[model samples]
Target chain A: MSVSAASSRLPGTVAIGRRRVSVELKQFFRDRNSAVFNFAFPMVLLVIFGSVFGGQEVAPGISFAQYFVAGMIASGVLYTSFQNLAIAIPLEREDGTLKRLQGTPMPKASYFIGKAATVFVTYGAQVVILVAVGVAFYDIRLPSTALQWFTFLWASVLGLIACTLCGLAFSVVPKTGRGASAVVTPIVLVLQFTSGVFFVFTQLPQWMQVFSSLFPLKWLAQAMRSVFLPDSAAAGEVSGSWELGLCAGMLALWCVIGLVLALVFFRWTKQGTT
Target chain B: MSVRDVRKSYGDLHALDGATFSIEMGECFALLGPNGAGKTTITEILEGYRRRDSGEAQVLGIDPARGDRVWRSQLGIVLQTDRDLGDLTVAEAVRHFAGYYPDPRDPDDVIDSVGLTSKRRSRNEKLSGGQRRRLDVALGLIGRPRVLFLDEPTTGFDPEARREFWTLIDGLKAEGTTILLTTHYLEEAQHLADRVAVISRGRVLACDTPDRLGGRERSSARVSWIEDGVRVETQTMSPTTVVLELAQRLGGDVPGLEVHRETLEDIYLSMLDDDRDEEAGESA
Candidate 1:
């Protein structure tokens, strides 16, 4: 019986996961300041970026609010995946919190599952909040059909996977807590800005636009826009089925890469390999 | 539990260089070392956390490098660092881990054993330093592991807390649980270990009963007594024989006489000094 197998026989994965969720929620939203960070901060950024931008030119016709809403939610993936995972994962590793858990017969998968689950559920709520604000304050419309909402959800999931993978890879190089934010911050900032979440990619210089397409951020934002915005309008950033397939494929590839790094570097003892 | 010539390296650094040791069923074995002495490397290999670079290791009849469900089920590990549940109470945390093992002890019983029953409902992060250490032991023992590994189990404890923790470990020893412990504190090693091994720089210097290592038992002892109201002292190879002679001269209890040989700590410190001298010599 392997460690994972031994852990499989245990019933505490879901129970522990539930406990971890309750604990994280309280810790992350314990105060008024935290509430601002978790909820209002992102909405404020959306407003600032959405209004201040000069209008974009797109071949497909769409409402500006519809286009901007998806981009805002893609930014939510940025908040949930890269920024969120980077801070939490490095802190856990530095304080030896993860080391302590590894010795227990707890299934290792539950740790990742618990973390990703919290991010997904919390960010899910944040997405609703962002969308609600978009509708109430910015006149953004709801998807006209169920299919569009489903597509938006699927695209968000892909973006989450890709960004999380990148975060995990980036976490490997940050050996200490104080230095970790410095290492992960620049990459996150550049990726977030270039991915077209804050602005349209085509309007950038041609060379910069080419560089942005290589990252999952642009593809994810592009895919997300395809879902939430009406196809009849030519106002969206991404154009065809080929771009959507490429985004999904690239995100899946990054998932494999992230999981591999996480497994190899995982430590569960007083002495850590990392 | 047996580990044979296990070796591990961290890039150019050799963390565990052919380290080999084991604890029989129901035995208490202590590993002693400084900060970077590879004690952790060897113990981690036994815990199935880090991969061994070379050689075979068996923990509870399974190779830890490939320990299975039953293998993992039979062993428990207590890390040097404490775990965080943030808001989960002590009882809740212990109960949570108890669900992971097939033959786990009762959560309440384990909590009481570690002297954390009063703090059972208190959030883990709210516990005092000693209280948290007790909670750490409670989680380790919850699984009723056949072999328990305790790494520097009581580093931040006060004198009273340390004594209480020792009593708890003695209770575990009485139950036939094998304990493999690593510690930096010499007094801690002397107090709890049935036998001790001193290692430095990725190698084991010696392994024996506390009184037997490094020619410890046969070394000359210091005898002190008040003779005719004047304090007198002498050194002798045999503490018991000296005491007997003093008894004969005094015609009874040997008038304030005491024969004291070097303690386990004395032996341990000498070993450490030897290590420093060797390093200095090599550099010179």
Candidate 2:
């Protein structure tokens, strides 16, 4: 059928990309445990961190709870986007679902869109969880100004995109679902630690901080912290500028590279791998 | 329909090497081959699933290699794997997929045609294996496809179900739907195919009517009969002449006489064996 005519009744479009997204969403909700892990695991991590560092101070100025809340929220950016992609993409590729869809008239890019859509929803859930827990337990207040909230919101969203791109890129290398955790878990933990997802970036060594800056994690964390914490508090977090625009630029660059790698190298079959 | 000199490979392994074949507008062409003999690669190429390194192939006057989206709407593919629709009833999944086609068969009619009406409302995952196969056939047909490619369509089917599937295929053939079946079941090919092609090592060894395949039908008829408490048999091209001579000798009809012609399976297995022996000798 003509693409136009074929899309006539497409739930979105019969494009393989749209089909992939829909099926992912369908299966995502069907597996209650999967949804729980995607949406709830971060909160569980939040509780653990919150209780452990409840009264202690990470720095002379920053309360452990305050610092870790933002760090945990930033980790949501990785957990929601990266964790989802790492688990879903390789599993789908292994299960022959990708191979099955290749036979259709759906374009290759459509599959990516489907994957991105699921990550987007999962991230949305993570955002709600992060904000709810931060406010309820840790006193991690929302920005006083709407503009600050917008900054936090946009920064958080951008972080998700960046991590998602990295995740999709990461998924292309794992040969099987078992290897997926091995491939994704380590890089995620490294990025998490270096990006200040679990600790204060300022306390790390100068070279370590520089290396962290090279990644989008630190940028996303710094930008997000600027909104979630008081303006007075962020003064101790980064430099005068913190290169906010450069942070966006670098993240966008990773987004482009990750996307390109995902598009080019991702194999739906073991045909070549085998 | 034509697939001209197509070559497809995955990594170091060549799947199809300049494989060429064609089917007419209203012909049932059976692709007979042992497992992993490149029948699937060729079919996938025709279905516009896999890209070939070199070839010019066409289905219904449109080149499958470059067939646009509209061309695919006219085709149907029955996969070996069944659909995985958990909650949706048989009618629901069929109705859902039917919406994708520009011209879809009525879901109810397709269900009935596949003999699934009694279980139409039941959830798809609850159906028996045979019923599920019927559902797959129904889904393949719901698109009102012009050229239906059935890959091992009757697989996992019991004897009765196999016969029913053949009848369904014949019904589709009567409706002028050009059916292409790739099967290991020689009986299925003998019963359903108007022309059968035996493929080995990514090449077509022979393509002809089942009756004429390997000269099985016209080569000779083997006749066995009872005479004087003993059984006698003769192999001759002219069975009627041999029967007449035997009748004269016995002074009546040959008792317990039976004439046998080689089955498609016999010829196919022998052809495959010969190809293997030749390969062995050449390797040695």
Candidate 3:
């Protein structure tokens, strides 16, 4: 007998990708503890840092809160894309979620695409909330020109891709799910401190400035600063100019590196792990 | 599906040492063994979840190690132990899995078939052990799989639940779906399998119909009777001859006569013991 009454043609990747995204979203939001913490932590940081430094000015008119808003946007993208996946993926692996998916007919690419899409949606919402908070309470200004908005768009998307890939690569480090947050949160915290998300990049110790430049966070924050802060404020940056091209280039480069590392390190089953 | 001389080793431990078995279409084939007897190893290889060190294996006319997404869609797996999808409700999990197939059964129908319709709206973690297993079966059936792999599917089930699960599998067998089952329960194999392979020490010791596994049908039967206020018992290859001789000696009617043949469990245990003895001799 035939397998079924319906057509036997396999569903397209697009169909499965969309379904996966919806399922991922549902799973994410349904877990109230994680949903609350993941979305709230970044905004909470923006409030605390914005309040402490709201009165200071770095470029004659740009308050520290305004400056901090740019860094927070960059940092928010990292939280949603990198930190979230780094913790979540390992947990799924430990729970046999990845193994279950591997046994299915879903194309492997669609699984990653679903994750990327979920990151994009959640990161997009995070940016909106961060921008709204910046404008309402921190006296931060929105980008005035279409070019600035365009810059905002590309910078966020590139950073999200880079971080998401990096997160997938980094997920293999934690031996078990219970220890993932303990390991992952510290690395993200360190990146935030050194990458100008929590402090002015130029004022950080010279060694930190040199070290953070190698990673995506510094470039992401710099790119965000270029769009949100005035053109005149670019002089205050460590490079003495808004190196938009370099920001894009470094992030693009990290995307490649992250992809290669993820391909090499990702394990679908615990038995495959070292 | 067929496996020829499949071998897998973890360092010094031979998980599947040249094990071989072939399952015909529409057949309920059971792999019976004790723990660490390579049942899960061979099943995982056929499911494409693991690669064999060296051998030839295929499922649905394709090499499982190289099986692609389309090849995967035609198969279903109920794992030995998995706690995934705990966050999704029963219906949600079934429907989500159904979307992965090109042609899938109706999600609600599959859920009902597994007897999990009552827990449809409950989260997977909320279900009892037996209920969770039923949900696993629901997900396995949602894709209308032509071949289903059930690895110790009812390991934690109560006796009543096990019977219900057997009935469910019987229904699948009726529908002509090829089922590959691995279990420690000999009765489960006897009740559901068309054929059973008794595996021990990473080898196929015997493969035949459940009734004839390890020559159980031809093996000696115990003939016992009450004679002269004493109980008498003897094992014989031909119980008819022994019973007739006893009746003739006892004047045509033997009191408390009883004939007993070896059960599948008895045959299976002896096979395992013999295998262990062989291993001990080799090591010495």
Highest DockQ: give the candidate number.
3
What would the per-residue lDDT of candidate 1 be over residues A93-148, giving only the tens digit for each residue?
77767776667666666666667776777688889898888777766767778767
Judged by lDDT against the true structure, how good is candidate 2?
Answer: 0.76
Model 3 ranges off by over 4 Å: A1-8, B223-259
TM-scores of the candidates in the order shown: 0.84, 0.85, 0.93
lDDT by residue (B1-284, candidate 3, tens digit) is 99999999999999999998899999999999999999999999999988899989999999999887777888999986778788899999999999999889999998888888888999998899889888888888889999999998998899988988999899999999999999999899999999999998889999999988887888999999998789889999999999898888888889999999998999999999999999999999
Winner on TM-score between 1 and 3 is 3
What i-RMS does every model get? 3.8, 4.7, 2.9
Best prediction by lDDT: 3
The TM-score that candidate 2 achieves is 0.85
* lDDT of the candidates, in the order given: 0.75, 0.76, 0.89
Each candidate: chain B TM-score: 0.94, 0.95, 0.92
Docking class of 1: acceptable
Docking category of candidate 2 = incorrect
Quote the positional error of residue A218 for candidate 2 in Å: 2.3
By summed lDDT, which 10 consecutive residues of candidate 2 chain A come out lowest? A7-16
Q: How would you order the candidates by lDDT, starting with the best?
A: 3, 2, 1
Q: What lDDT would candidate 1 get against the real structure?
A: 0.75
DockQ of all models, two decimals each: 0.32, 0.19, 0.53
Question: Lowest summed-lDDT stretch of 10 residues in model 1 chain B?
Answer: B65-74
